[model samples]
Target: MGGIGIMIAFFAGILGSLSASDYSQYTYVFCAVLVLTMIGFWDDRKDMRASHKLIGQLFAFFLVVVLGDIRIESFYGFLGIYALPISVSYALSIFMLVGLTNAYNLIDGLDGLAGTLGAISCGFLGVWFMYAGYAVEGIICLGMLGSLMAFLIYNWHPAKVFMGDTGSLPIGCFIAVFALLFIRENGEMHPSAVYKFHAPITAGLSLMVICSYDTLRVFLRRIRRGKSPFTPDKSHVHHFLMRMGHGHDQVAMFLGAIKLLFLGMVIMCSGLNEHLMFPFVVGLTIAFGSLINVVTLKRMRAKVRKSPPISQRYPIKPTATIKSKSTWEDEPVLES
Candidate 1:
């Protein structure tokens, strides 16, 4: 029953707005995410294969990029690159869509974590879209925000329901779409436009920095350890906070604050170039993650030193539950 409420609320809002002028232009986006939601729903119940899920994700994203004509057309001068070739644009767009969809799913660990973060990002983007004159896209964001807020009532600590793959996949896909749109639209804004971003790419990345950074860190660690990147483990940022003795609600609030901190940094550095702002954001995130890791490790070491010797201690039984083979369905496995 993951995100069943979110789906219902979101669709109902979309339906209510169908009569708005020129709203049909965004119908493909609606359709694309709808397809993703269905795929996720199927996986939630039937435990779809990883490869099969990837195929489905790729198909949905391709429909949006190729048919809907929504994509990253330029690098925003990162690495001194501006516009991209058509083939490169298509490849980049699809890769980002699929990567982010799963990256978001991977972060859906603790109660209220995903839903809270989703609301924050969507709320920010929704306000910006409305102010920037993207009414349809803004409405989409608000619709998501509304659904997530309602879902959070039941999804708080001691959660009654999880978003699972069903909610997270489409939500991630939806956010990725808006992020790309933000970059493209902001770049094309008139020089005098007040709401235009000086570093659109950086701002877009900031909206998703937490989940993106965690996913990259987890994958790199897995590769360094000579294991599949998708292997399950307790190495996420939320896990680190838990190891340091934070409650579920506290961890959710802390991560939410980190996200807002990143957004604040982006706003404060609005005058900087994308190349400069990009590395600054990445470095700040790395520094914070490293700090958390060091603290967590030190605490664990201290606990070990205070415990009885291994030879004298009673053997402890494993309390971890056995997860399924389906990576997308498992509790600990990385979906991306």
Candidate 2:
């Protein structure tokens, strides 16, 4: 229902001011979102296999990349690479779309987490797009921002409504598109442009650092444990926070602050080259994730140490009479 409301609001917003050519440009995006929304709605009602969901996501992303021509055409000079081969571009675009969509989906574990993060990301992108003179994309980003703000009203701690896969999938995919567009637009900006980013790729990634890093961390941990990467488990960052005694609201706010911090870092470092900024952002994210895990583990161990022994906590009581070997007399037998 939240996802449906977002789509309705987005479409209505676009229909108001966009011309024919603008509508044509976004037709593929609309179609792809519709496909993703349907797939997500279906999965919400009848959980789909991970592989099947991947296939569905691939098809929707293909529409946007191949037909809509909204793909990463370059690496923005990261590692001395600029233009990419067509095949490589298609593959990279699809991988990013799928990865980000699932990353956002995975972070929906806590109330208001996903919606709050989504709003922050979309709001930043919207402001960037408008400042950079991309009205259509700006509208798209703001449309998502508006819906998310509304959704968060009911999705805050003690949530009245959950997004489920129905909202997460499409919302994630849309944010992925915005990130891609941000990278492309930033790269194409004139060198003298006031808002142009020197590290376009890194800037784009900073928008989703938290959830993407969490997803990558969870997948690696699962694989290391000899389990499928998609295997369900309570090993997410949110779960760790919960174990550390943080309430849902605290966890959500803490993560949201971390996300804003990343955005601020990217903005402050906008003049840095991708080579330097990329590694800095990646290192910071890994450090934060590792710190969370270490703190959570220590807290758990401390908790165990503080707890009383189970046998002492639940003492056995004498329930029957038994003969003692030495005394040859009746003695009380204690049963646990």
Candidate 3:
């Protein structure tokens, strides 16, 4: 599995002390990932309850936060926001982490969907990490990046192997860890890396634009329909694309390509003012949300039009008063 490969790499780093910035803490990361993967594999084998799975995710988040020292300390001055109190940061950190973990898991439906997107997201984040002189985290990112690329070979359309929870859970962990680290202000920015981000948080948002937005879109939709937000359904963004006539590989390609485009834009716009980049990112998210909604509605209408009419479905009977003359009309009967 892809996660298994990354786990080995992390172990190697721990044994060799090859990481910079004390990135050698992959032992903690590896242990945390093993727990997550176990829970995921359990779910794949026996369909674990949503609450239990969430608890596992929380445990993973807690481990990284407490043991790995990976927690939010600042929002990088977004909206003039500065340092958060210890308690508030803990709560906020775990919540964003658990939410994004579930978001990544949710998007892992179709063949190559999660794997391709994971590679893109982590690939760029890894490059940015090394670019900014964060080698250990960058290595972890690239570890995940390489693992996911290897995964896509078998996970492509007509997938020969599947990630299931075994892969999805840790991939989410990687994204959360890297994205949060990406947004953290580690004193001053490296000169070469400065132009790679306007506000580092925007890069995080852009890297995960589709997954984050689609997760929000589905949650709101389920709640609006009076269903639990965790209820599973075929209403994901990929489902919408499938309804629009795309196959597994095609949908994955389009979505991944789009995400890659936004990521490139994020890098390009990194030189712009944070104030400008923030709005640009938010506006793009809003636009994507609106577009998906319209597409969902269109898919619904198309489905309705394709369905048989009620009378045709039921085969409504003619009135007895007018049917007495025919041999088949003397008695009321249901049609199969």
Please state every model's RMSD to the true fold in angstroms.
Answer: 9.4, 5.4, 5.6
lDDT for residue 136 in candidate 2, whole number 0-100: 83
Task: List ranges where model 1 is wrong by over 4 Å.
Answer: 18-21, 308-336
Q: What's the lDDT for candidate 2? A: 0.88
The per-model lDDT (C-alpha) reads 0.88, 0.88, 0.78
Q: What local lDDT score does residue 71 receive in model 3, on the 0 to 100 scale?
A: 77
Q: What lDDT score goes with residue 287 in model 1?
A: 99
lDDT of 3 at 259: 91
Q: Candidate 1: lDDT over CA atoms? A: 0.88
Better model by TM-score: candidate 2 vs candidate 3? 2
What is the Cα-based lDDT of residue 307 in candidate 2? 90
lDDT digits (tens) for residues 183-287 of candidate 2 = 998898887888999899989988889889989889999999999998999999999999998999999999999999999989988888889998999999989
RMSD, model 2, all Cα superposed? 5.4
Question: Distance from true position, residue 235, model 1, in Å?
Answer: 1.3
Worst 10 residues of 3 by lDDT: 319-328
Instruction: For each of the candidates, give the backbone clash count.
Output: 0, 0, 0
